[model samples]
Every structure is written in C-alpha cells, then in structure tokens.
Target: MVTYIARRIGAGLAILFVIAALGFVMLSINTDAVVRGILGPQASEEQAAALKADLGLDQSLPVQFIQWLGGVFRGDLGRSWFTNQDVNELIGLRLPISLSIVIVVLLVTLVVAVLLGLGSAYFGGWFDRATQILCILGFAIPGFLLALILVTVFGVYLGWAPVVGFTPITDSLPGWMRSVTLPTIALASHSVGAVAQQVRNAAFGVLNMDYVRTLRSRGIPEWRLVLVNVLRNSTVSGITVLGLQAVGLLGAVVLVDKIFAIPGIGEMTINYTVRGDRPAIMGLILVLTVLVIVINLLVDVFVSVLNPKVRTR
Candidate 1:
C-alpha cells in the first residue's frame, strides 16, 4: 500500500511538472504584449525594456522557467503585475472560498447520488424511471445556465440567499452556509446525476456477480449483503466519477462564482485573465493544477483502500 501510494504521488508530481511547463510556455508566448499591457501604450520603449527586465522577461525562456519553478517550490508565487500584491496572498485569501463550495457540492453529490442510485437499483420500478429521467435532464442542462436559474429564483425572487457577495465561515457560520448553498446546488445538480448513474450501473453489476449469489445462498441478511458487500464494491466506479466531476467543478465554479458574486479563485481567474495579469494568471493556473493533481491522487488512494486488488496492480 505504501509503495502504491508513493507511485501515485510520483505520477501526480510528474503531471504537475508537465502542466506547469506547458502553462508557462503558453502564457509566455506574448511577452511583448504582456509588457505593453502592464506599462500601457504611451509608455516609452525604454520603459517597456525596463519592465521586461524587472519581470525577468528579458532572460532566456529556460532561465525564466527555472527561476519561476524554483520560486514556486519555495512557496513564492511572485506578485500581481498591476496591483503589486503578492500572488500567494491573493490565492490564499480566495482558495478557501472555492474549496468550501467544492467540498459542499461533493458531499451533497455523494450522499444524494448514492441514495438515488442504491434505491433505483434495488427497487427497479418508478424510482428507477424517475432517476433515469432526472439523469437525462441533468446531462441536458449546462452548469452555468443552472447557476443563473438558481440566482434568479433563490437569490432574486425568493430572497432566500443573498444574490451577491460572500461571507466567510470564519465570520459567521450561518452566513457562510447561506452564501454557499445556492452555488453548491447549481454545481452539484449535474454531478449528482452522472455519479448516480455510475453508482447504479456498478451496483447492478455487483448484484449479478457470482459472489453476491453465493452470499445470498449462504443466508446472509439482505441489508448486510446490500450495504456491506454490494455498496463497498460499487463505490470504486462512483469514486472515479466523483473525481472527474471534481475537476469539472473547478472550471464550472467560474460562472457560478460570477453569478453569485463569490470571491473565489474562479472570480479571480476571470479578472486576471481579462486584465492580462500574467503573474496572477500563471499563479492561478499553478494552484488549480496542483488542486487537480491532489484530488486525483486522493481518489486513487481511496479506490485502492476499498479494493485491495488495486494495490497489487
């Protein structure tokens, strides 16, 4: 198990390195444009040259990459080109907000999806039909559109949740819950359906397995058979689906954060991208990449724990 986890971590680090290099190359493509955007049109050539030198853009690409990578390893994300604020500071302030929403969405998705999937598979009647219909609709609608609808109904018309702005959980628990609830629902709406379908399919396959029949023939309690044996075996697929959904949610939160005025990394992403703040944008990309890697790593470890066969592989 330790070896398996170590291998997974090594692979995750490799992926992070590759993604970081690619992001740096892509973002460095228009160095002149970045300098111009930072200094504005009226700035002299000498001013632009000095700005480029200050930002280490005047160095060779490899040199700059090495320097940036070193700084990242040292926990220094540099500073915003425009505001001169520490990129790490900005990310630190916003990351928790995004994470809070993501964590809530995943938890809700897991509970609701497992229940729906298990019920549909076990009952095999109207419940199954309704779950299928909901899954279709979930796939049909986009997350952003769902976020908009949520904002309109829950935030605007009903006044249940505040339409704009967020309150940190550190400030007030209830306020934070209210702030995140609608956004969580909007993001989880689609994830729940996808995960539920995966769970239902996995459960069905498990139920049909020879071991399940043997356990039944051995007079195992129905509830224990379903909950212990069936549920545990079915979880691998659901977990894979949830990991994919988590990555998708990282992108989906951009629109949801915008609609709800949540001050998360997603909102910061748009603001920096639009302004061409290379440092801030690159920092955001790095943070997001790391997040994706960590999430996938965690998923892999969890799957290995639930299925010892995975560890041997």
Candidate 2:
C-alpha cells in the first residue's frame, strides 16, 4: 500500500510538472502580447527593453521554466499579469467558496440520487418509471439553461433565494448558504439525474445476475440478497459514472456561478477567459489540468484497490 501510494504521488508530480511546463510555454511564447500589455504603445524603446529585462522576458525559456518550477515548489504560483496578485493567493481566497459549494451540492445530489435510485431499483413499478422519466429530463437539460430557468423562476419571481452575489460565511453561515444555494443546486441538478439513473440501471441489472438467481433458489431472504450483494455489485457501475461526471463539475459550474454571482474558482476562470487574460487562463488551465490528472490517478488507484484482478495486473 505504501509503495502504491508513493508511486501515485511520484506520477502525479511528474504530470504536474509537464502541465506547468506546457502552460508556461503557452503564456511565455505570446511575446508580442506580453510586451504590448506590460509596456503600453506610448512607451519608448528603452522603457520596453528595461521592462522586458526586469520581467525576465529576455531570459532563455529553460531558465524561466526553472524559476517558475521553484516558485511552484514553494507554493508560489507566481503573480497574475492581469490582476497583479499572487496566483496562489487568488486561488486560496476563492477556493473555500467553491469547495464548500461543491461539498453541499454533492451531498444533496448523492443523498437524493442514491435514495431514489435504490428505491426505484428495489421496487420496479410506477414510482420507478416516474423517476426514470425525470432522470431523462435531468440529463437532457443544458447546465446554463437550467441555471437561467431556476434563477428567473426561483430567485426573481419567487424570491426564495438571492438572485446574485456571494456573502462571506464569517458574516452568517445561514445567509451565506442562502446566497449560494441556487448555484449549488443548479450544479447538482443534472448530476442527480445521471447518477440516479445509472445507479438504478446497475442495480436492476445486478438483480438479474446468475448469483442472485442461485441465492433465490437457495431460499435466501430477499432483503439480505438485495441489500448486500445487489447494491455492492451495482456500485461498480454507478461509482464509475459518478466519477466521470464529477471531473467536469469544476469547469461546468461557470454558468451556475454567473447566475448566483458566486465568486468561485469557476467564476474567476470564466471571467479571465472572457477577458483574454493569458496569464490567468494559463494558470487556471494548469491548475485544472493538474486537478483532473490527480482525480484520474486516484480513480485508477481506487479501481485497483477495489478489484483484485486490477491490483494483480
């Protein structure tokens, strides 16, 4: 287990290094833009030269990369060219909002989806069919459109939750939750449908397996068979789907954040991209790339640990 963990950590670091290198190249190679932005057109030739020298824009790519990597090692993701603030500081300030929102959203979807799915699978009839129809609609709706409808209907007309803006949790936890409730719900809505349906489908499929048939033939109690074996087997499929869906959630939350005016990582990323802020774009891309890669690696480890065949292989 220790060896496995070490291997994964090593691989993760290597992947991050690669991502950082690529992102730096993307940001650095745009020399013209960097020059123009850093030194306005009004600047004389000597002023531009001095600015380039101070910023190390004239340095070799290899030297700049080494310096950047060292900063990253020290948890200094460098300063954003546009914001002129430390990248790590910016991310740190916004991370809590996004992280907390994600947790709540995931909880809402997980609890609701699992209950509906398991119930639907265990008792296949009218209730199951109704949930199935709802699940289809859930998967069909675009995230942005869902946010718009929800904000317009729930926030604007109903006045149940705030229409926009995030409030610090330090001020009031209840008030903060009230503000972010819309964004989180919007983020979790589609996931609920997809996860619930997947769980239901997997559970139902497992119910028809040969082992289940044998258990029934042996006069085993229905409750034990369904609760233990059926649910366990079904999780393989359900969890797989859930994991994939989760990877995109960070990037996909932009529209939802816009609707609720949540100052989160997604909001920062989308806003920066819209403004064509290359440093912000490259930094965010690298951050997200590392996150996605780490998640995939964790998934691989999880699958290996869960399945004997995979571990041995």
Candidate 3:
C-alpha cells in the first residue's frame, strides 16, 4: 500500500511538472504580446526594453522558468501585469467563492446521480427509461447554453432565483444559496448525467453477477441483495466517475460564474486572459493543476480503501 501510494504521488508530481513546463513555454512564446499588454501599444522600443530588463524578461527562458518555479515552491505566485497586484492575493480572494460553488454543485450532483442511478437500476422500467432520456439530454446540452436557459426560465420567467450577480454567504446565507442555485444546477447537469450513467451501468452489471443471482435464489431480500452486493461494489466505479466529474465541475463553474456575473476564480481567470496577464494566467494554471492532482490523489486513496485488490496491488 505504501508503495502504491508513493507511486501515485510520484506520477502526480511528474504530471504537474509537465503541465507547468508546457504552460510556461506556451506563455513565454507570446512574450511580445505580454509586453504590449503591460506597456501598451504606444510604448517605444526603448521603453519596452527598459521594462523587460526591469521585469527580468531579459533573462534566459530557463532562468526565468526556474525563478518562477522557485517562487511557486515558496508560495509566491508573482504579481499580475495588469493590476500589479499579487497573483496570490487575487486568487486568495476569489478562490473560496468558486470553490464553494463547485463543492455545493458536487454534493448536489452526487445525491441526484446516486439516487437516480440506483433507483433506476432497481426498478428498470419507465423510471429507468425516463432517467436515461434525461441523462442523454443533460449530456447533449452545453453548460453555457444550459446556464442561459436556466437563467431565462427560473430567473426570468418563474422568478424563482436572482437573474444575475452573487451574494456572499457571510453577508446573507439564504441569499447566497438562492443566488447559487441556478448556476449550480447548470454546472452540475453534465456531471449528474455522467455519474448516473456510470453508476447505473456498474450497478446493473453487479446485479447480474452469478453470486447476486445465487443470493436471490437463496431467498435473500431483493433490497439487501441490491444494496450489499450491487451498490457496495458499484461505488468503485461511482467514485471514479465522481472524481472525474469534480474536475470537470471546476471548469464548468468558471463558465457559469461568467454567465451569472459571480466574482470567482473563473471570472478572475477570464479577466486576466482578456488583458493578457501572463503572471496571473500562470498562477491560475498552476493552482488549477495542483487542485486536479490533489483531487485525483484523494480519489485514488478512496478507491484503494474501497477495493482491496487495489491495495494489494
């Protein structure tokens, strides 16, 4: 188990390194655009040269990358070129908002998917077919389009939620929840379908196993057979789906935040991108990469705990 964990950690670290290197290289390739973004298009060559020298853009690419990586290791994510504020400070302020929405949506997706999947599998009739149709639609729709449709119907027509803007939970919990509800539903739509489908398939497969039939033939309660054998074993696949969905949820929330005008890491990212804020973009990418790695690690641990074969391996 220790060896397996170590291996996973090592692999994760390697992936982070690759991601960082690629991101850095890609950003570096657009150095002129970054300079223009910071210095403005009217700046002369001499001014650009002086600015580059001051910012260490004059340094070799390898040296700059090393410096940036060192700062990252020391928890200094550098400053944004546009606002000249610390990238860490910017992210620190916005991350919690985005993280909260992502977490809430994840919880919503989990409950909906698991219940729908297991119930549909157990019942296996109209309930199953109806949910399957819903799942197909959920998967077919784009997140942004769904967000707009939700905003149109629930926020505009039904008047159930705020049409746009976010309320911080600290200021007003109920208002915050009300503000987030539509966006959460939109962000989680794809995840709910993806996970539900995986769960249904896994549970259905487990139910067909020889032992499940044997137990059923031996007069075990159907619910017990489904719960103990089908649901329990199905969690391995379910966890896998949940983990993947969680990562995707992060990206989805960014688009949702923009559509809803929420002040979050996603909104921050879009603003930085529009302004060609390289440092902020790099910082955001690093943070996102680390988040993905950490989430995957946790998922691996969870899967290992649930499946002894994984631990043994």
Candidate 4:
C-alpha cells in the first residue's frame, strides 16, 4: 500500500511540475507587458530591462523552473506578479470557503441520491420511472444555467435567502448555512442524478449475481436479502458515483459560487482571470490543482479498499 501510494504521489507531483512549468513560461513571457512595450506607453527600454532583471524574467527557463520548484519544496509558493501578496497566504484565506461549500454539497448530494436510487431499485415501476425521468432532466441541463434558474425562482421570486456573499461559518453557522443552502443545492442536484444513475446500474448488476440467487434459495427474509448482500456488492460502483459526484460538485461549485455570490476561491479566481491579475490567477490555479490531486488520490485509496485485489496489483 505504501509503495502504491508513493508511486501515485510521485506521478501526481510530476504532472504538477509539468503544469507549473507551462504556467510559469506563460507568466515569464508576460505578453501583456510585451503588448505594452509594442504600444510604447509605459516604461522605457532601459526601465523594462531593469524590471525584467529584477523579476528574474531574463533567466533561462530551466533556471527559473529550478528556483520555483525549490521554493515550492520549501513551502514558499512565490509572490504574485499582479499583487505583492504571498500566494500561500492568499490561498489560505480562500480555500476554506470553497472546501466548506464542497463538503456541504457532497453530503446533501450523497444522502439524497443514495436514498432515492436505492428506493427506485428496491421498488420498481412508478418509482423507478420517476427517478429515471429526474436523472435525465437533471443531467440534460448545464450547471451554470441551472444555477441561474434556481436563483431566479428561489432567490429572486421567493426571497428566501441572500443572493451572494459567504458569511463565515466560524462566526455564525446558521447564517452561513442559510446563505449557502441554495447554492449547494444548485451545485449538487445534477450530481445527485448522476450518482443515482450509477447507483441504479450497480444495484441492478448486483441483483443478478449468483450470490443473490443463493440467498433467495435459502428463504432469506425478503428485505434482508435485498438490502444486505445486494447493497454490499453494489457499493464499489456506488463509490465510483460518489467520487464522480464530488468532483462534478467542484466545477459546478465555481458556477454556483458565482450565481449565489459566495466568497470562495472560485470567486477570487473569476475576478483575477477577468482582470488579468497574474499573481492571484497563479495562486488560485495551483490551489485548485492541488485540491484535484488530493481528491483523486483519495479516490484511488477508496477503490483499492473496496477491492483488495486492486491493492495487491
């Protein structure tokens, strides 16, 4: 297990380095600065040369990469070019907000999806048909559009909650939850449908296995026969849905955060990208990359646990 985890971590690090190199190259070239130079508005040639030297932009790409990699190893994520602030500090402030929203959305999506999906599987006909329709409808719409629709009906028309801004859960859990509820729902509803689809597939597959027949032949209680052995076999696929749902929740969270006006890393990222704020952009991108890497690593571990043969492999 240790060896397996180490190998995956090493691969993730290598990918991170490649992405970092690309982002650094883009920033070092500073096309905006080049455009400005061509336009001849700000800084003289001598001043520009001095600025390049100070920023180490004149260094060879290899040397710059080495320095950036070294700083990362030492827990120093370099200063932002657009803002003088430290990248780590900025990430520290914003990551919690995004994480909190993700956690809430994940829980709601998981519980609702499992209950509805399992019920649909256990009780066929009308229940199954209704669930299938919901899954189709939810999966059909785009996340951003769904969020806007929800905002219109739930926020604008009903006036149940505030439209935007994240109130810190640390300061007030109830207030924060109220502000976040609609956004979480908008972000996770489609994910629930997706997860339900996977659940239905997994459960149906489990129901056909020889073990299920064996239990049925033994005259096992009908409820226990369906719930215990059947559910266990389906869990691996259900876990696949859970992981996918959580991941889907992340991107949609960005859109949902925008619609609901939540103050999260996604919000910060949008602002930076819009204004071409290099430092903030780099910081947010790296933070997001780290999060993806971490969650994917967790997914691998989960998959292995569900099937021990995977661990041996």
Q: TM-score each candidate.
A: 0.96, 0.88, 0.94, 0.89
lDDT of 1 by residue, 165-270 (tens): 9999999999999998888888998999999999999999889999999999999999999889989999799999999999999999899888888899989999
Lowest lDDT sum, 10 consecutive residues, model 4, at 31-40
Candidate 2 error regions (>4 Å)? 3-7, 213-224, 274-279
> Model 1: number of clashes?
0
lDDT by residue (3-110, candidate 2, tens digit) is: 766777787878877877787786676665666666677888788778678667788989988887676677677776666887777877887887777767767877
Error of model 4, residue 24, in angstroms: 2.2
Candidate 4, which segments miss by more than 4 Å at Cα? 31-40, 216-227, 275-278
Clashes of each: 0, 0, 0, 1
- Clashing pairs for model 4 are 165-261
Q: If the candidates were sorted by their TM-score against the true structure, best first, what order would they fall in? A: 1, 3, 4, 2
Instruction: Provide the overall lDDT of each model, using Cα atoms, as 2-decimal numbers.
Output: 0.91, 0.76, 0.88, 0.75
Between candidates 3 and 4, the lDDT winner:
3
lDDT of 1 at 308: 74
lDDT of 2: 0.76
What are the per-residue Cα lDDT tens digits for candidate 3 across 256-287?
A: 88899999988988888877777899999988
**Deviation from truth (RMSD, Å), model 3:** 1.7
Clashing pairs in 3: none
1 or 2, greater by lDDT? 1
For model 2, give the 10-residue run with minimal summed lDDT. Answer: 304-313
* Most accurate candidate by lDDT: 1
What is the C-alpha lDDT profile of model 4 across 1-313, one tens digit per residue?
A: 8888998899888887778778867766654464344335766777777666766667787897787778778888777655667888878988888889888887887778877777788788999999999889888887788778878887789988776777898889898988888777777768888888777878887777898888889999978976677766666676777777676666666677777777777777776665555556666666677777887788788888767677676
